[model samples]
Target: MQYTGASIRKTAAHFNIPSFKAVSQWERIYYEQGKDALFKEQRGRTSKMGTKRPKKPKTNIETNEDLLAQVQRLRMENEYLKKLNALIQKRERSEKSTK
Candidate 1:
């Protein structure tokens, strides 16, 4: 493997890889171990045991109501933060004018 001193991102982009981390990992493995190391599969191949989680079923109306509630909460939070910021700026302006 001839590495021409190219940046990891550039090499990843050249190979059309979405994540540069994968390219860097491969590069590290290639440089540390040998080319043969890259040929081996990932460590967790044989066991393939994954955690299972149960899914909760929610009705469409309930889901929509939950989403709307979250949206309203976020909007109220945004408005409160805006007002707080305006008050802080006003206080700072008043302090500056007094000095």
Candidate 2:
């Protein structure tokens, strides 16, 4: 009825339905997926089993040597950050003492 020159509001009113939005949605579903799509059970909330979470992709670090190299790099970064923090604290203390 909506596709045949009838307005959504008028069609909804004539059918004694609550809102024109519902009519519009039905028309959209009908056009997109056809009539069979309307008869299928609607899923309100997706169950944990129904949803498949995408897996994280594996990195190029496949060997033990690669893992060790990454750990060493992280350790070096951590040491650098610690040294920077200590320097900042020492500078602040010196400034405070001078004041």
Cα lDDT tens digits for candidate 1, 41-80: 8764476677887776755546778899999999999999
lDDT of 1: 0.87
| 21-65: candidate 2 lDDT, tens digit per residue | 989988899999999999988768766575677987887647998
Per model, state how many residue pairs clash. Answer: 0, 0
**TM-scores, in order shown?**
0.40, 0.44
Candidate 1 at residue 4, lDDT?
83
User: In model 2, what is the error at residue 9, expressed in angstroms?
Assistant: 0.6
- Where does candidate 2 have its weakest 10-residue lDDT segment? 43-52
